[model samples]
Target: MRYRHLAAASLLALPLVAFAQTAPAPAPAPAAPPAPADVPLIARTQATVPQPVLGPVDQALRVTPATNAKGGKIHMLPATLETTQWGWFDNAQPPVLTVKSGDSIALETMMHAHNQVVPGTTIEQIKKTRTDYPGRGPHSLTGPIFIDGAEPGDVLKVTLNKIVPRSYATNFNVPGMFGEFPKEFPDGQVKYFYLDLVKMETEFLPGVFIPVKPFPGTLGVARAEPGRYSSVPPGKYAGNLDINEFTEGASIYIPVFVKGALLWTGDSHAGQGNGEINLTAMESAFRELNVTVEVIKGQKLEWPRIETKTHWITIGYDRDLNIAYDLLQKETVKYLVETKKAPDEAAATKLMVTNWDCRISEVVNVVKGTYCMTAKTAGKPVAKLPTAETATAFVTVGTDADLNKAMDTASMAMINLLVEKKGLTRLDSYGLVSAAGDCRVGPPAGATKTVVCQTPKSLWRTKTASK
Candidate 1:
């Protein structure tokens, strides 16, 4: 049951509405560049807004992505910063590392077997590795990477680049693990696969080949709730989503929760069918996963969805297929209303009935789910959060206490632009300058001028209704 609701973030109605009709308008030119490191943002804020603790701005906000010397994306070690310790995905857990939008991460994921099924591994020995795994689900996880500037009400785009197979991968079915036909295979089954990374496929049996469609079966961010969370269920936050669409070259867009969108993923599956009815995909230990994780501001989503080269996939999970089915349809309807902006909800439903392909994602994860995909037009990207390099101020608001330092925390670029380029006095710019706090345009209460992201008006036609 815990594994069933592996997704942690809930699917709320979003304002990033471009789902229905043809192409969305082209995005306007990006605002100016990030202010020079030496410039300060302290001059144009209210006396109350807190100055931000200028830690690493992270390459995410920069013009180019962060890179390493080896020409590979930054490598994330399981035991390193921001990475998770075991398998469970808890938002309350601190991040092992901080990355930025458009950053590539090459992470090594532990197998569902963890260290249980090595060459001399045994069942009795494997049980010890699953010590606290009952509610945590089965696999070992790698991270809770903190993406800079990510926050609740935003979106995180996970683009799969590559899945490098490790030397060997393992698979097993416990006695009661596959509930549908529990009696069919009573004894636990442990099997291993010799990875063929070069060929990109694995053998199920002689002459029976299964293409290696490696995807993180349990990829997601923390739920808004603060506590230990199960990696079993797939929710809006997309943990253990298990959908096959998450294979290489696909993109998963998830709603952001908590600042920096604490994200983690694992449960590498070399292959699996839609229902995963028999339990487990072609399980594998991935040597490396090349992924680009970025933040999309101004986009809102109710569910964790997928965009492949061919389809727009909507997902829903629940304890009951019937309920999950309804949730799936409702999400489709929301897709019609928000993204499609269908004037008639009923009409959208009718069209959806004709176009959507709803399939069983899984039935065993106590939390069953149905994922529906519809033929979708490609090319239009969800309008991004505004990027005003100048004239706009930004800030980070953690507690009510941070308000006092707002002025100091504001971007120096904003102050410089208004005073130097735009010719507004510091106080006047502070008056009209807006942070994400309160939308008041001119010195309205709580202007909290700090590094902030606001929706650009032109993209109003872009998508979801704001909460």
Candidate 2:
């Protein structure tokens, strides 16, 4: 696997790798006279330290009560409760804090739940509670500070510093509720696993240890709509986007909704697979996340874009995979054409066909939703063609030809197809053959070849391709 170092521009004020192993000690006592209360907060802090705060929640919100439950009793706080079930608390909104590059943040949390043990409850009950009060259950939430002067059309960069889950827990479906293969097992079965909150440990398998990398499953800002919106589905405002890659050191760009884009983040997870098949992971209560946010003033995006140390990922969620693929293809084509200046459709198609580096990331959630990503950096560039003297005399292939002749014939056939079907000029065809052509034969020995041609820089100097 290829791993690129995080961009220096995105690593705002954050310490290197070893800094996050433990939290920093409290700042030393002030040596001189205490500063005046009237002094501006930003100016005062900026004078002392160049780095800005990355998290909106300050020291004040860190205080939370710790609780646990076993058997069937709400052990510690029975006086205030009507039933044995654990009760939910007020849903705190995520802080709208600005994050600059190189800064890392740490958070502390305690697990609190309303349900101690309710054997007869169904999926409906859990769903109802979650619906009535969001952000009270195991949730993921975190936002980064964007670079100053990032306009609307540009992208806001985020690099995750560290994601550590303090205490963790996983819940299984109750009897007659839900199952992985519901059609095969209708009755439903209940299983639960509890973690040692202090140790921060879990046993996913007999000999495996799953280290926690906490991240908010629903991290986004407010929508463009006037009133408050439910944090269920992701929209233009970027809410409840359950993308799993928002970990430490992974940068994300969200379209700005309002000035300063009040971003709210909550929902931390230990780990999860694509589509979150179970609608949950090893759901945990307490988490610490460090992030940096940069503002992009004018760069507007239709959907959220994420970049890890390795891959560039674009997410498309639609009701149909075909539609999603079409959108993905269009967006990728646009990126290639606009950025690389591939002049015409034929050149672009050749690049896609010859490379085949683009692929479907996942097919899950397609019936209800589809998520797909196309990568630009995964494929090797087409090789430049040989000189005219070495050009293999072109001949069309047919099914009747032998295997070796068929291969050569197929290449010629593709050349012809490019001229007839794609309406390429003779120069265009020749340039394509010389610079960007290759062939691959299938298992049954059928012949196939793809021709690739990149537009000269001068073409884009005059006009650009549009989606």
Candidate 3:
């Protein structure tokens, strides 16, 4: 959500201590020197758009890809202050690096709210940075990379090859910038964590270990619009999506907007729950993140979609959960219909209802998100929502915002309930709810919609001893 424009002096009055940072030290040397003015920045160029081979309209517009134009060149873009854009995405921003389609980039990304939150950084410093650049997102995105021959009506296929996270991470909950349960936690709290790469897991809370699954929290091409846009809320351009599914080996197809399809990424995370209920995940930096970019012509898409080895994920975003869910469903139907897998919309809807699992992406991103996952091959459907159990404890908590926010509150409340009633650790509860808890929307009451999530009764069957 776009926050109200605040005068520079107002930042001092706001609380920052509770929502600040401290972390690993960066070397004194300049992260990376900027390209010299005399040096040519464009690594590759295509004077004309490639001719297309017509094909069926599948999930990513089934058009054949242009010949690999990389020519064995890989670009390295470091996350220096000069190369990174703090909190905004503008089509007009100059490209730090440009390359032909089908090239790979070895990129480094900073922590949340941009790279400003390093060790010894103060709350006032973070606030000052915010005031310096008003009306933008807090993420430190690292490019408006220009891809030769990219233009509107084309699809940019981005493949994530490797994502190696830095040793440390941070998570926070700010009071003024409340997440799902606005009233539940009145104060802000920030926590730092050290990750173990060899173990491939983090001891989040004493004995509670969480598997590491790092991904770029935000990545997308420039929007069709001409001016600058806040990188806070995700749109068709795919900014600030915080989708956990974008881990290594996943590919996302984005619709080209302006020519060259200005691409950028930031807001990296090591691990996150499905809802991201607290507004922050394992917000961290990446030491080594590798990605390959390709431009596909003769095909277009209305929304961005992700492809994993096992399933296709269709994403939808809106302030209203119902509307977002509807958009996700329609996108799924469109993909099925275009691919000729379903004879018509009715059949596609049936198949979607039977085979797809709808999931809440995140509710804290100002704009809420919902997505559906359909297996690549036919099989029994997988369930995600919490369900009734034969012998256990179940609890439903209610709060108000959008329908998705209600679900967020329900999720947070259930997590607390699990920790208290089942003797489970907070991390344990969070992991359990994220992977298996189900949330539902109830009829709207007055100005606020009611959302509910419950723990399965079976949770009480086991004795959880917190280490």
Question: What TM-score would candidate 3 get against the native?
Answer: 0.75
Please give the CA lDDT of all the candidate structures: 0.57, 0.39, 0.69
Residue-by-residue lDDT tens digits, candidate 2, 1-467: 00011112212121112211121233486786665988645566567885664643353243224321211111111111121112111122233333332333343323223332234444444444433433222232333222335444545554565666544455333222221222322333222344544544444433223334455655565454443233334544444455555566777777765544555554445544333322344455444555555555555577676677765555544434335545554554555565563686667655544543332222222121223233546554543332122233222332332322333344445445556644664333322332223332221122332221121221111112211
**lDDT by residue (tens digit), candidate 1, 1-467:** 12222222321111111211111233486986889999976555575788786664343332234474434346455422234344456666666667767777877776553434455566445544444233345666787788888989999998888877566655444444343334533555555666676766554433334456677787888788776655666778888777877788899999987888887877777766554543465666677787888788898798888889888788777766556656777887888777764667898787676554555565556676667776666344433223343233332221122321221233223434445644555432321222101110111124332222221122112123311
Better of 1 and 2 by TM-score: 1
Task: Report how far off residue 428 is in candidate 3 (Å).
Answer: 12
| 10 residues in a row with least lDDT, candidate 1 | 435-444
Q: Name the weakest run of 10 consecutive residues (lDDT summed) in model 2.
A: 71-80
- Write one digit per residue (lDDT tens) for candidate 3, span 1-467: 22212233332222121222232244486655778999966544553556686553232221224423455357777886656776677787788778778788878887755566755555445444555444556787888788988989999999998999999876655444435544655454555667888867665555445667898888999887766666777889887777788899999999998999999998888877667765667778889788889999998798999999898888888866768866887898999998888999999988887675665667766677877777888876565333333244365656665565567567877888878866875654654555335554442236675555655453232224312
**Using alpha carbons, what is the TM-score of model 2?**
0.49
List TM-scores for all candidates, in order: 0.63, 0.49, 0.75
Best by lDDT: 3
What are the candidates' C-alpha RMSDs? 27.2, 23.0, 12.1
Q: Arrange candidates by lDDT, highest first: which order? A: 3, 1, 2
Clashes of each: 58, 58, 4
